[model samples]
Target: MKQPLRLHTPRLILRDFQREDSEAVLAYQSKPAYLEHYERPAPTREEARAFVDMLCRWAEEQPRAKYQLAITLDGGQVMGTCGVRKAAPGDTVAEYGCELDPACWKHGYALEASRHLLTWSFETLGVRKLFALTRPQNLSAIRLAEALGFHRVEDGRYELTCP
Candidate 1:
């Protein structure tokens, strides 16, 4: 995608990550619940800053292969992050992922944001196939992916193909 990219849902706005989002990203990522499904360590302040910077840099690339955006609630509050990323530029296949704050869980924000992300991927990004890898224990993510029409093609991996 390109700069100023934004996707809207009934209750959320998936917009490009700004430099000011670093603090909110850091705040949620520092919580234990954020890393419950993943084995990676919690992000330090510097790591969070670097991540935001990377997202911003990716937005500016000439042939961008990634679209990781901050999930905000109706133009306010950074609730989480969502992305649809091609494995390589010009590839028709891509993978998607989303991370919502623990507090935002159960509100269906992830599902809403993810559906919008996939639509943009298929229609705007020309992605013909999309997949997601979620930890088995993360049932919420599994359900969200399924709701978006992805089926389990292998252990911990789900996929959907555009019609």
Candidate 2:
């Protein structure tokens, strides 16, 4: 099956990553607020390019193991990213991750984009289970996951089992 490059919601579009998005992504992730909960330091532009390139490669591979979609406003401004990566062998699960521009916080974009991905995971990818991990102190992310119907499965881990 061909993986869709763009998913539409009322207010956002989750589309494929592009070189042009590097600057916008860097603008958000480079901030201290955005990187505070991340274990690694904020990435430089070069690092972001390398990261995007890797994601693009994965998206192109057959039996794609990752879906790295750029979260954009309806007007097409790069606002964040939302995607899923294959879980490790024996896990039979996939992990979801997202990062949004601080300027776009509190607008429900994360939850909307997450719901879209969860639907794709279950209906399109035929994934049986999905999960996410976030810093416990990151209340916003935690709330967003819960709102997307992912329950707390363990410390820093939330899960949604397909019905």
- Each candidate's lDDT (Cα)? 0.89, 0.83
In model 2, what lDDT does residue 113 have? 92
Number of the top candidate by lDDT?
A: 1
Error of 2 at 93 (Å): 1.8
**What is the alpha-carbon RMSD of candidate 2 to the true structure?**
2.4
| Candidate 1 positional error at 135, Å | 1.0
Worst 10 residues of 2 by lDDT: 84-93
Model 2, 1-163: lDDT tens digits are 4564888988888888877678777788888888887888889899988887777777777767788789988848788889888854334578889888888898888889989888887887777888899899999989898888889989899998886
Model 2 alpha-carbon drift over 4 Å, by segment: 1-4, 87-92
Top model number, TM-score:
1
Which residue pairs collide in model 2, if any? none
**Candidate 1 local lDDT, 35-121, one digit each (tens):** 888788888889999999999987877788999989999899798999988867799998889998998999889888988888878
